[model samples]
Target: MEKMKPTLTVIMPAYNELKNLRGAFISATGALKIAGISDYEIIIITNTKRDGSHDGTPYVAEQIVKEDSRVRHIHNNSYVGLGFKFRQGIGDARKSFITWVPGDNENIEESVAGIFRHIGEADMITSYTSNTQVRKWKRRFVSRCFTEFCNLLFGLRLKYYNGICIYPTKLLQKVPTKSDNFAYMAEIIIYLVKSGVRYKEVPMEIKPTAISSSFKLKSVFEALGTIALLFWNIHFKRTRIKIGSIN
Candidate 1:
């Protein structure tokens, strides 16, 4: 008998991405189909402005949920961090594995399909952008610096720390993450990798989008603080425990 394919739960976080939400959903579904993943579901987490206003993204997400039974929608009353949205999706995921795609339509269909194609080959699928020239100079500089800093601090050589990664749902749930901001994924990756979980790195390419929420001064400072705490926790505070041994 042929081997059964693994099921996946895709978490899409949309913050004022009215123009790209539907396209992102369609692209993700298409990529999943291309990768031969038939048993999968998408969870769209929609966010609005601090004043409880949006650009109709929530409505668009609702339409998607209505059009597809595999799609689920979660609306936030105000703007919450990306990490918070992902944590919510992770808790609600009902599949064997979990991954996230941004609703900004930055990730190309081929890259997404490539990531999914490597599913079940390792404990996790970590991706790195092959074409960094697509981003602005400042953003590229910041990203490079961040990746280098993470590698130095963690004593590992990884090309990227914040790309779209796939992890087992139960394993991710068992690991503890404290950051609810953009730096949350970095924290999770460091924890899991340091704990000796096997992972595979894949290359991805992204398209430039109209809006970017990651380069703000506030977000930069928040990420720095979170990394500092994470460094301390990993190097000094926590005991060395392998992820596979976690209960």
Candidate 2:
């Protein structure tokens, strides 16, 4: 039997992201090309219908599909949230490794190579965001408190939950999405910890422009909801299973 080539799947979920899709995709694929990982595909999932302002996300996605044959555009036919689109992208992935990069050009090019390099040793790899001075004091305090609470709640102290996550596709397939919204990332991380999957954290610098444009309040609520769900699973659910070491 011939050996099968390992594939890397990049899931980019977007909402009102027509302006950044092409740049983000070009940067990400360019970095991947430099890493010498030729077996890869980019899945762009858009939920523009729910954004309340027709930003022509779908049209832009179509244009991307036409321009980059390596990219696949998935329309959010049923769901209307970022989490839902991401879940669909993950479910459709047929690759050996999977990574999610924000569609707003936040993820740095160099970190993509770092993630692929570390994936050999860890089941999951996450990157930390660069500190920015433009954030409001209250937002910073809330994020810190929420992050600490997440560490305590899930026993996993990843610097940023949804910032940039890379993991084995099989691991994600084993423990699928429990929530269909923005809480999906948090739920996945908690599940990975509870399952004992070996994970690592690396520091990466995020673009200040991306940070300034992020939806902070909405992200906070999503994280809190994910933490609540994790507590429920720990104390009241029977989803515990052993995940092997990072050997």
Which structure among the candidates has the greatest TM-score? 1
Question: What would the per-residue lDDT of candidate 1 be over residues 1-247, giving only the tens digit for each residue?
Answer: 9977989999999998889999999999999999999999999998889898999999999999999999999998988898899999998999999999999988999889999999888888999999988888888888899999999998989889889999988889976786777789989888888888889999999998543777788889999999999888889997344555321
Across 1-247, the per-residue lDDT of candidate 2 in tens digits comes to 9544447899988766778877788778877876777898899887645434557777887888998778898876543766677778778897788888767775668766666666556678876666635456665666567678777766665776655778777677777566655567767877787777777887766555544333468766765776687788776885775654322
Candidate 1 off by > 4 Å:
239-242, 245-247
lDDT of each: 0.89, 0.71
Model 1: pairs clashing at backbone N, Cα or C within 3 Å = none
Candidate 2 pairs with clashing backbones: none
Score every model by TM-score.
0.96, 0.85
Candidate 2 has a TM-score of: 0.85
In terms of lDDT, the poorest run of 10 residues in model 1 is: 238-247
Q: What overall lDDT, based on C-alpha atoms, would model 1 receive against the true structure?
A: 0.89
